[model samples]
Target: MIAARSLFRAGAAGVMALCVALAVPAVAGAQPYPSKAIQIVTSVGPGSNFDQLGRVFAERLRQKLGVPVVLENATGGQGLVATRRVLNAKSDGYTLLLTSSGLATMPAIVKNAGYKAEDFVAVAPLGQVPFILYASSSVPATDIASFMSYLKSNAANLNMGLLTTSHITTMLARKFGKVVGGELVEIGYRSSPETLSALLANDIQMVATTHAIAGQHVALGKIKAIGVVADERTQAVPDLPTFKEMGYPTLVINVWEALFAKADVPKDVLDKIRAVSREIVSDPSYLTAMVPTGMEPWRIPFDSLQSVIDEEAKAFKKDADELKISFD
Candidate 1:
């Protein structure tokens, strides 16, 4: 009886030791993180160039991270919907925000956005996209000077299509009127496609938009690109003159998107993500994806991103204040 009892106790002790050995690695070391899926939230609707950027990033992440990276479109409020969603998510590297240049100006322009530029940290910056001022082929204007003359002659009679009254494009359109001697009545639309359609149908005379949406239209000879709102003419449209050359030097209105995470994300995690971003932006595949849309690489390292963001915010706020613009 004594021998049997001793044997049973020893067996139980062995079992406990085995169980502890099995559990220690899980509790102490844990699995290499991101062992699961990741998600990228974007502010644009599906089929837009912004959506395409998200898809491209997700695809590259899947290949690099060896896990599925999904894209969630939370389109509304210019970008607050998507921004808030990511802000409220776990600071774990699993959730990310892929947004446009609007991220820089939206809060100042959109009332009750409930967030500031400092709330999110920039992780990756995709290059700047210069806005092209396109005029309908039916319009008599052939060059920037001629276009200004037309605006002066028409004054308040000329209609311009814009996404919103507070949008940078709208501001540029208004500034165009101010630069020349016309009113250039603003007409709002819900999407870039609608604005393009309005311009195509001659419902609106001119539209200030990105090259991606207007490039094909220009190719088809349906519209003419008269002014480029960029510091320099883009390679995609080298022949197009910058607004400065056209005598509107400060009319620069380049738009760009960047990947962002919550400010509290762990340094190690953010480093991992930034490293991944460096790879993604430099990948030949990414460059190919951008080439079609006239987008060039604009990657900022993790450490310098905040300073850049701050500077951009300041510039945007100054511009907004000068314009006396408030979306509300």
Candidate 2:
């Protein structure tokens, strides 16, 4: 009888030990994550253009997430700081980064940028701005025809003001200049705002920038928009004809800004973020608020974001090599 009782006790202890081991892991896996505030990092400063746009989405995300969405500015190096931070964040969904087209363009513009084209997966394309070619009012060109004519006789006197050579803005501008045999003089600014300022001062003959950046100046008659370099004429400035309309598609370049998270993030987290992003953009108020700022969310446009990332990175790599754009 004693032997049988000892055997029963041993069997019970084994079963109990197995149950504890399984339950411990199950409980840990079930723990809720992101039970606290979240963060959205931007490469632009407070009150800046990005900050204004980011704030709108941040507020919207807060409503959907039931968690505070904090906006942090990690400016300079053309958004490299913010990108690195996102890559280094813990594998939790609490951190996200709001970035511009530069997220894809910077690696090409800066040498040894330590990131490749496929580094960040796109959560969603948040917004887009059409790029326009503007000339200092000092230049006598008023239309595309006059602009071409002026380029013919005054090649030596012309200079192009650019924020950075790695930008799609300058790449498209360069190709257009080459096709027309203009070979414009190029000047670089530290930032887009600085480039716009130089254009108003007539520091250069022409500038390639977005609609909203130079819209106020154009309205004030301080600068003249020579052409729209985007796929279509923006509704905000319907009068400016697109490059395709002008019979030259090389000038078509739209600045697409999107949200990116590290590629290694969990699928459930990515899905949650993607769903929230799509919902936020679809909000009617978001459309109304963003349009006036010269931004538009593409409406169900077919974007295989993975493919877009690959293509942008390849194009930049090629441009950097061909133009010899490098930091070291």
Candidate 3:
């Protein structure tokens, strides 16, 4: 009996040791969130505004998080490829998406977007870039009023260039056409540069594109900016008046870029990211680098970020329905 009791005690001691050894690894694995590198997948390629902003954001994230932050440019599919890639990633907050306002229009246009704008929770807003209505120098319009008159008189002959049918600029262009009572022909191009090139060659009478792309040409007298599609005049072109200021309030639209993560990512992780993002956007150095790119700092409150995205998504869907616009 004494020998059996001693053996039982030894067995219990061994079992306890084994249990503790197993628990040790579990404890170590639970190390605070973000123990590994984070990847930011941008929806655009290098040299694009989205790519440039994403790189700067990644650098800032690395500085704050003390972890390697990688930026992957996953272009193509009209921003759907990168959007789906981030959506399919593990909901651990390690894989993030950096996309533009085009996200809001995906569901409205693409038949198999496979995701909605609200599917990903917004982590931070990068900035808002105003859209400019640029006209080829050959056109007889210098300002908004005269442009409206010219558009009405030459609606049958004038052609408007678009980067893509699904781009936000497409909706703005359509709205502009409605406001001016002209069925302006929209010619879709593969890219903004191509669209602008068409305008430069006088292949298209007008183009609605971001200020960043058209600002230089306008400054050099290559094209004329008829009006800006913003709530107010942008610092990039203070002399240019907004469509709203010229009496077209419905044309006030701006494209915004933002960071987003999977919706199911833990609240704590989202909070941490939002906190760091707020810090980065508010940094003077970040503003100095971004402002010259014709992007205005847009700091949507953390709590209001998702709501804003939802609203934009709804608005885009409404616009698409009204315009009968669909890619598929």
Q: Compose the digit string of candidate 3's lDDT tens values, residues 54-173.
A: 788899999999999999988888888899999899999999999887776688888988997667878899887777889999998899999888887888798898876346767777
lDDT of 1 by residue, 121-193 (tens): 8888766667788998778987788887787778687789989622777777767776775667888998888
**lDDT of each prediction vs. the true structure?**
0.80, 0.76, 0.84
Q: Rank candidates by lDDT, best first.
A: 3, 1, 2
My TM-score estimates for the predictions, one after another, are 0.85, 0.88, 0.92
lDDT of 2 by residue, 141-182 (tens): 898878877877887688888765236656765775666776
Candidate 2 stretches greater than 4 Å from native? 1-5, 8-29, 164-166, 300-303
Which ten-residue region of model 3 has the weakest summed lDDT?
164-173
Look at candidate 1 and give me any clashing residue pairs.
none
Q: How does residue 280 of candidate 1 score in lDDT? A: 87
Q: How accurate is candidate 1 locally (lDDT)?
A: 0.80
